[model samples]
Target: MSSNTLSAVLEKLIHRLCLNDFPCGYGTWRKTKGSTEGAETEETDALLDLLSCPHSPWRQDGSWSPQTAALRQLAVLTPERLHTDFIYSYFTTLHILDKGVSVVDDGLLKFSKLEELVLSANKISEIPAENLPSTLKILELRDNWLSALNSLTSCPPPRLQYLGLSSNSLGSHDVVCHLTGTHWPQLVCLDLSDCEFQNQQALLDALSTLPCLRTLVLEGNPFTLAPSYPGLTVDSLPRLSYLDASRISPEERCSFSSLSKITDLIEDRASATVSVGRVRGIPDPSMSLDENAPDFPVITYGYFITYEFLSHQTVDLCCSQKVSESKCDAAHVTEDIFSDADLQSNKNLSKHRTSKLTWAECMDFSDTQTYIVSDLGGLKRFFNQGLYLTLEEEKVLSWPAASEDRKGGKEKESPIKSGSTKDKDKKKKSVPDLVQDAPIRRTLGSVHVPLQGLVKRGHKVDVLCDLGTLHTESELEATQSLEKDLGKKIKEDKKKEDKESKQRGGSGTKQKNTAAFKGRGKGNKESETDVHTDNSVSVQLEPLTVELSVELEKWQSAAEANQLTLPHKSKQPDLS
Candidate 1:
């Protein structure tokens, strides 16, 4: 071992201690002169006097030289001193932080009276049970590289009360079995947070044997995301008072009382069913236009709902492993193909490199015209934080009488434009332009429906969300501008078409019979008058209120005979 190692440094310090005598004090053996003559006094009296002295070496000092503190502490103790005396006379806590300790050796066992051993933020991979003292009550090995506890658990400290093994890789189920009450019977607090433990039932069942456990921290574990979570753990272990630093209240205890039954304790998979129902109270866009017009322009509307929700899906480990292997092979092949001598090739290779893998759950939002029924992986997200549903209205205006004219005009212009421009130069217009030309859509309002309370009602419940009669200023302004622009464009197009028609009819009708020509001209004039009257009309619209219903169903894990079946949606209903 290196001389800078913890065991080596401690061993070297112990060798410098005075073993034959109490190095801090002077002793004198004298007979009592009053009653007994020639009687010798014990040497312990001098040792006690030295301990009580203000300048005793055993006394800790804030001003003590850091280089000599270890030597002074060693000098005050002798080999013959009792472990209990050492504990009471000196310190019983040993804190070693950020030390490059790769292994725990027997050198620590020399501190027989140690009650607390904190070896946090070290590189320790193994802690042999023989190296641990029986008197230790608190053992904190946080932020270490420990992957298994077999050796330590083989002979665990009998009186251990608090064990902090957080931020380690002790994720295997077999390793967790050693943490039962059979090993550490007196354990009162245990911290296994940030570990890789994936099976919740196994961990909970193993920890339930602890008779005195009160505080348990299991945060940052994969199983922590399970919907059952703290409730399942609380009910499984009735003696527990605190979970992940939060105190379990009596009401929570009562709610999870059913979980205490062994029959009810089953492993759960992440799955849920969300059903969006009928929407009501959509405003008529035609109401915003003039009511007493001669001829009203045809107005069509399409309504849809947009909502953001948490979608959970479980990924197969085997499939992920295969994918990762294939990706690695592909990367190797690409590296071989691109030579290091070519700087440009290297840069191009870097651009194509795969990004870091992620397993995070993100929010998923969808837009649908009617009711939506989706099967999600879990309802944990909804239970933690609710979702929002937005109501949107789409309005499309069409002039049925002039539809044929517009189609004929587009057909006549298509061939001329196609012959003038090359195929590469002829690009389609962007989406915004198309949207601005015809349809106008805007959000009516959004309602936040909290699913937490609804979940408590039952496994499945219907939720009615009311989007109040409030629309944002931006939405109202955009809709108004779109309507005004569309109306103006329609009137301008109608006027141009009327002028062209009069020019064409003027020469032909004048050359023909006068009576028939006058009748035709009068009919054309009346049609133009009606179109002009419709264009001059306008109306005020009232505030819109929207209400939607949704059905949410949650499925919990079950045993072989009690398997849960998810609600199936065969066909979506048209709520438009």
Candidate 2:
């Protein structure tokens, strides 16, 4: 490593330490094994895929629950993974905690120094504890269905510090704790947390006999809190230094005592919040419905954001291997061709040159300010000029690189220096000046990027210049045409909406059909009555005329009042 490299690394560590843990977002990480296809096997690749999953929106996936997807992606988010070695090595503590690790098989673990055994909180139902590590210090059987402690009748771990029987639907607490005098003599720290430790005195008294007993954690065991028989105070038992009978306080001797392997707290709020709770929308479908789903459609959207990896120029290919991409002439190329992709003109090739390798033609952004380095490594340095990236949270494919040849061509394509031609012409006209010809020693190779509106969502993202595949040309055109069509449709929709609005406005001024419909049966009955008895009807007509006049006046007032509501539609228009 160069001094410059060391300095860069130190600077990055400082920067990272000072930064608030950013939420690993779209492009936080990408798949290590870039198949752009099926199931990922490698953890790094899986990690990358998990990190990158949020960035890509699948057109066919309307049922993708974001929380569930995040959970699946963050399976390796636990602290044990930070040591990576823990996942691969297990010679220290005879271990068998293959709880819920769905994909991992038993063959991977070495189980040499592995002493602790926790098959709790898993799909596992039973196991022979006797055959486990003789050095096993703890046996976590919580959250599983283990009905008997007799399964360990043979030879349990000699130095077993803890035995968790909590949450198992197992009966016979007496038999489970029956090992105090016999089979499991070294059981010191026992966690019957959430277990039916109902036989308190029997269990506690039996447990009290364990000569090495120091810690008893009986969380969620309500029986422990029940009124002590006769008059025993809860704290009267004084053999233990720590007793976790209730919920752990943040100040509770730093969460877990000396017995826990997991960290008490994960301080990275951004990462922690991202993994909180079971992923939503799994085994729950009622969330997608509304009181009235028949009337409207629903939609969801996502955007991908990005940054550099590892805040440095060179990237770690694995745990040790490193690769540095050299940057030259302020440009880079991204090509799909592996062999003969680069087309070097025969004229440009020297006699000694045997073959031309075409990685791909490169393209530079319109006008960007960049240093003219002799190689591509310098370009990567530009990305890390700020902070450590390489976070897989925001998984995004790298921006396209421009080839040296193309960059060279682009460099030539740049506008010529002003006034240089005039100066050269004058020198050419004068013989003395011409004879005094001196090569211009002063040179400039810096490139200034021209300003352009970037992709709105990808503004912070590195722009990958694509020397897209030849077959993709039609796809590109189709995409462009689609965008144009969408724009056109949007404009048309607006116009149609405006026209409808205008028509409504024009019609709103007319009298509303505010007059109530006359009640039917009574009017027909009255007409028949009038025909059947003309003389009789004429006599009653005087009274009817007076009542009808008064009703007419009242109806007119109501019509005026109802008209007020009709214009309300015109006041507020739907923006969507």
Candidate 3:
């Protein structure tokens, strides 16, 4: 039973349900809630279970009824229901025949009014669609044993939208040819996710023309085919608004700010080899990172390739000089050699394309760096072996390498000797001589050498590594031995400076101190002199007191005539 049939059946049942005509197929065995002869009851448990089953029914009786059906809208399976004649008479709108139901055939055409059909998770090996109804709109056929979709050609429902054909075992040309034929007119959402599509060209070409397609989800699909690289779905789905092709290794969430790995590319398959490609990130639309920010990121990049035979075109740094002749060999060069044809006329440029390495040219620098770092801890030794560094160890060995023996076991000495003659005109000033790489005496008791070298000759002898790092406390104290060498010089200089300062200063240094003390002493003497003068005056005042008293008595007599009391309490404060 399809959705149309189910809907019609439900509408009819809701309007008029005869309980006497249809009691559930439980056979009156389960305890009853009511005893009314024709009263309607809700079959919640039985009805829900029936929705997912085949076109059969458990009727209003004590047993199963494969012939008769009962429900609001859902019609369920009664153990075994196969052909159209069994379920056609009943009306159902949404039929779910999935998983174990591999028995459907032209019997599906019986539900002429179905709007939604689901037959997923089944073992349906083949579907002959000659009897497909036109009323069908939404169809779900996921997780099935389907290999071809070509059956939908003639009777393809014009109103079909939201088709979900995911998790199907589809792998054939017919499926491709059928889906590629015409646009699903009303189709807006198609979920063909996890279908493992092998024919990507046809799929992309067909889907690009879908006028109504807006939402396409194709996660976990291996999307690649002939002449095309994997992940074309990410590029071809132009109208898709959301994409989730995150990496498979780390289930961890993405850190979009670190997406600046684009700088590693100088050429890519999409930009260099193919005419079509998706932008790394859209500025106006957030198709990549920092969606809240109103700017699209620009990817920076460079490219590389593997070289089969690398030669040189200019002076190589490791070029050997003929000792007696004192001249460099022209065969050695500064860089890799180019093909004769490339040097003359760049034959590959005839196609009006700028010359660049394809996947076939030179080795990637990352791989080379990884190799050098693994063995030599950095690229320093790799470059030295290739372009510089004459090895003394090669000469010290009694048994030299076959190549060395064939050439002659003699080694080239460094151009410079320690603190030697300054006749620089006798030699060309290239990089520093290897002899300078010997241990440098930085402290008193022990010697050390620099781990790094001059980047250029004219560069200053600035500290590469901190001197403090190279010494222990004991080692630092050992360097105090320098004070012994400079003992006489430092003391003599100090004495001379002290003598000169004393001569220039004269006696004025003590004059300021002495003048301050002298002023204080004079002030004390002045106070002492005043005290002495006061004492002498007091002695003289003692005799004059008698004369003053007589005068004071006479004055008191005069004051008494003016009504003043003798100058006792009258002239004094009140002690009372």
Candidate 4:
């Protein structure tokens, strides 16, 4: 029989057994103090066995009620006792935690006026919304095995104001979306502390759309580890008053707003720069090093420098030749690159941003010198010295020709040499004369320091280091020997290939002579056949050679026409 029909029949049986004093006369089963064990009475045993009878809907492991082990003292409190209005109507709240209640018992369905339910610490995999009464306002289902939120969507509690679903398995993004739509309109507080959402952004985004959500508990979640979570959460959900149990301060909100605006502006600027198709970080070819340029110090330090200041700023350095080529009326190109409006904007934003140094005063660079340190001493020593260095200028030691340009020069060399046959006749070019590549610069061996120690205060000093030459005679001799050996090997290989080809050609000619003279003694027929073959080969090659010449002439004519049209187009533009 169904739970309802069996409940009805049991109710009648209980009423017949104790007609007037059924539930109130015998006091409710009391816990035995200091007694941990209790044997089941015959009546309770019979009732339990009947509940787990064959074909029962609630039977699991062939046991009478898997969830009622803690209720061993009151095993006789069957569905019949709970079905009465006198017993069920007396309670509006129920606490069934740690009871192993896998199923929402038929006994709980009788509580039509139930307002609060605590089913935490149980094996309840799911909650039947239809089984739960509509009067429930607060449902605490913490530490359960519920994997879905479909129960709430199916029979949504209209008056549910508080829900505690911490440490549950309800982590689906779809469930989060379903939650924000048309369910729990009166829900003002929600506790989903440890739901383990994999997509944190989706969860936060869905929560942003909840109109009545004020306080939210998301402690122990992976999203809490994000560095900007506080700012992002406050920015995303403006209505959220409390997040992770902390109140959102007004100052924090203002800071988040400013940060968001700055990020958006940076993104827009980057996008605009990209769309303009301007190449960045490439040094212009015209910017050659000025050998006569004077040395300039970029930093200074002394006892007079009581205060130190630091700033995080970006500097844009362009090629000097490019600056000159712009041909603007301004005295300097740097000023034009950094416009007045942009400088003012940077100055305004600088007030809001903090500097790294402890002191704020500026330094006086007059009567001070900064040393150029070698790369041998790394960052550790530099940081200990409290010195700063900025790369003011760089001089490229040598410029290498591009591969395409070098290949083109090589291809044109043959044609140029053919026309200049008289020069080759006079004297052949040497290997060094033919090679067109920049020589490697000599490395500095030893630097000469005039003074090593720190100078006295207010003393003008010029420290000069004389680096010794690194190109030794022995090294030069070794390089020349290596190059000579490589050239000799290349020539030998070429000569060997030519000798093998000549030998093969001689052998082939001998074999052909024998075949042509086979079964003949100085015969005229053989000579005639050879003459015919030679004529036939020449006749076949004549048309191909003529066609190639004609095509070459046509191409040359087209190129000449294009060259003539270019000046006419240029002259027309100039005249206009």
Candidate 5:
């Protein structure tokens, strides 16, 4: 529109032409030794002559077509005189094939007489409708990557009668909507073959908007794959005279009843495919698993069908849309007053945010409980501790106790079943050692499983082992607290006993009692004897606490080593 805009457009064209070979030699016309007007006149005449003749010394082999020869001539033509008002009046046709031409410059817009433009096989990603000459009647842009055709509706060629958009990516419905009857009243021939359109019916429905469309090319498309493609195309567009390369006739037209049945079958197949994709519990094909692996246990009567159910519940809570939308700043007030966070704060919550428990929290390695306490809170309470997560694989949950015993590289023989009297006594002593090591061979928590088949099979399940040998960390802490309380009580009792003795006896006897209590308290041997004699609580727990501490340290080390050997967990199957 402006002189600056015209100069910029001309500059880009000059850059493109410089990248390719000049058909008439670059040096012959680039630096013309004459007046600017004379040089302009000389180049304009040469270009028009090249287009008109279609035969030249450069293409003497007759291999180059007339359109191909004209394109090469125009590409090499110097851009120095393109801005001149009357310079474009000489050229009526321009074909620039494979020249990487993306933009049609405003300089080209001056071609008021341009009737044909062939820009096939170029890098143009969009239709340059605004810059196209109004006199353009035939425009071919084959093999271009045009994703939008809406621009043509906004600024179309006033006298455009033929359009070729073959091999482009014009698949969008919005693009079809733009090419309506009102937008291009003079449009007659439209070539959209080998495009990205897949839906046959939708394309035909959109094309019906073009009231003047006579010649419609839809070859090399999904629509043509249909059995009744010829009949359907003709019936859809009653005025389409030439369909692809074939001429349509009245005898080929089919009845409306046949068309109805064909549409119904295609629609039914499409809907069936969509429904199958929505099914759940399907394993991904990319992953490999053992063919002999046991099938998932059927959920007889449990809260969850699989581990996925528990995980999904927690995921839904943590990743809720409301939580994401709510501002993180403390000053922000959420619209939902009764949100999870609000309810938690009102009830003085101190635990983790979500109700779902972590694997570590579910385990309690204490000897106080009769069963290994996996805190499935609501599940345990509602179902009367009926659910027991059985380990499908042994190594997943436990560290082998035999591995710890084998550290010394000494192999122990199995105890004889029917031995002598001496062998019977040795087996009795070794029995306690085996019993103590049994907990290390088993897991601490439940293995979640599916309940689909189990419900129909009527199989009975119960807690296999209580795991009473392992003491929880909480139990150790409580033991330490009790020891402290016992020591304090002993000190208070000793002081009270000395005060009572002073009131009943002489000063000399009272002094002896005070000295005995303080001096005896500091001596380890005397203090131990006093605790056994005077304080029953401390004496009984001291030996047990020492034994438990040693066992806890050994178990912790074994647990860490076994964790390192465990394989990474696989992605769970979707059990929707």
Candidate 6:
């Protein structure tokens, strides 16, 4: 590329990567004000701003204009600095996604201080180890056309902690064998998903050498179809904390302990049953009240379960028209709920709308839920491809006044007034009104289940999901208090600004006033107490967990058995 093209691309990339530090366009400094004095003042301010920016390396002593100096520094795109005065030493992170880079050229070595380099979704086919900086900790080359990793294996970055090579063509066992700890001693995470490796045992054995490899992704490989699967891989690499993006749960590790040795007995096809049980250990709101407060509102609680899982079954659009319509209606309700001017006034309405949407998605009314799996192979593939299975506890809280109103309404409608005693005794009881205000719903906690390991066992599997509440009442109170304090501080600053403006008595010139306004705006932007208002509340608290139980089992289907027993057709003699 030409120098101008390279400069523009680099400037745009830098601006995108450091958006917070350089909010304005890179060429903003080139614009001059109307008057000479104003232009000088603005230029001085711009130079100061550039110097103060966290990402900019331009010094105030530079002979060229601030913008020109920055662009010149970016223009010298060599592996090593062409001149001694270049500012490449300040670069720490470089992200060039989908940039059509066909090679890991020597130009990248200019960034001596670079730590995180992401060149994902590029046209690159090879990564020369010598072109990489020694200080790199994160190197991602995902979605590239790389087939061999000899360059990386021959000379790896010593401090490399993360290496993303997913969606490549490295399927050969010889190529995978280079992923040993000897090459990348400090590699913590390695992603090789969708590489099409076939040898399960060899892949696992190679990965087992990495001492600090806590996370590994081997999905989309043919070997994932092996009956042993994740259990074998898990047992082989005992130190792995995560496999294929799913956390290695303690239960899974315990169940799959030494499972690699018994791989021969594992079945290819099996039916499995999974059940989610009731939740417990929810804190009672009434327990926090004192005995003397008898008149305190009656606090009521309702519970439900919500979960998310990858469904292998494809949805038929023609059959799901009614479901789609209902979802659309729910979407409209959500928009209406959030559009209200006063959120507190329509809190109940919003809660109902949110509940309706949740129910349409994954909310379950029953305390217990069950699922059966007949094809272990299909389930294993879903799990291997980073399928997420989560169970959550949802709690609904009803205020005392609402509960009392409901009770009073029931009592007033219960008795008959205009009838004889016999008639009144024979009268049927009145039914309660169906239209009631919605209760406040909150998600207490959720847990991720390792389904791959569970199904691999091919028998009954019981799992206890530990749900932890992210926030407490005390934490909410503290957050509210902090927000109030920030509001007060903002009000006080505004008052001070108003007083100062009043003291000027409208005597200030337009330019000075404009400058003053810009200064105030910048100050407001930088203020730590500038509270950002959002629809949701934020709070922090210690983990308070509740437990729910789940059970799972697998069995072989009759169709699979029949297929295995069917004899192959014999060719007829002398048919030709």
Best by lDDT: 1
| Residue 352 displacement in candidate 2 (angstroms) | 99
The full ranking of all candidates by lDDT, starting with the best, is 1, 6, 5, 4, 3, 2
Q: Write the per-residue lDDT of candidate 6 for residues 44-155, one digit (tens) a residue.
A: 4454466446676643233211233344334322213323324456666667677666767666676687898887787778788988889999998999888998877778
* Native-to-model Cα distance after best TM-score fit, residue 385 in candidate 1, in Å: 18
User: Candidate 4: TM-score?
Assistant: 0.34
Model 4 lDDT tens row, 22-67: 2212222222344354453234454445445677432233122222
Q: Per-residue lDDT for 1-576 in model 2, tens only?
A: 332221232233223321112222223332334445435333445443534566643211212112323333333343233233432232342223322422223232334455555554554445555446556676677686566666565556677778877776543654655547466677677776555444445565566566776666654443332222111112223445556643323343332232111112111000000000111111111222356533111222111111111111111111211123123211222212111211222121111100111111221111211111111122222222322211001112111122122332232221222258887577446423111111222111111221111101011233222111122223334456655665675566556555655565644432221111122234444654564454221111111000000000011122232342234225522211
lDDT for each of the candidates? 0.54, 0.33, 0.37, 0.42, 0.45, 0.53
Residue ranges of candidate 6 with Cα displaced over 4 Å: 1-40, 43-86, 225-227, 266-576
All candidates: CA RMSD (Å): 21.7, 39.3, 41.9, 28.2, 25.8, 19.7
What are the runs in model 2 whose C-alpha is more than 4 Å off?
A: 1-109, 171-174, 229-238, 245-576
TM-score of each: 0.43, 0.28, 0.31, 0.34, 0.36, 0.40
Better of 2 and 6 by TM-score: 6
Off by over 4 Å in 4: 1-83, 105-107, 258-576
Q: Higher-TM-score candidate among 2 and 3?
A: 3
Please report how far candidate 3 places residue 223 from its true position, in Å.
Answer: 1.7
Lowest summed lDDT window (length 10), candidate 5: 268-277
Preferred candidate (TM-score higher): 1 or 2: 1
Model 1, span 1-576: residue lDDT tens: 776455775554434433334543222332224435333443444544554469877444322113334434333433335243453335467676775777787867767777888888988888898888889999999999999988888888888999999989998977878889898899999999877677778888899898899999987665554445556787788999998888989887776675545434334433333444444444444445556542223455555555543332211112112243345321121112222233322221221111122111211111111112121112333443565666665566444332233443241222213454564244333111111136676776777766654333334334666675543333466557656765676567556656666776875554543455456556656755665456533332333333433333232322211333211112212111
**How far out, in Å, is residue 340 in model 4?**
53
Q: Of 3 and 4, which scores higher on lDDT? A: 4
| Highest-scoring model, TM-score | 1
Candidate 3 C-alpha RMSD relative to the actual structure: 41.9
| Colliding residue pairs in candidate 5 | 298-451, 298-453, 298-454, 299-450, 299-451, 299-452, 365-471, 365-472, 366-472
Better of 1 and 6 by lDDT: 1
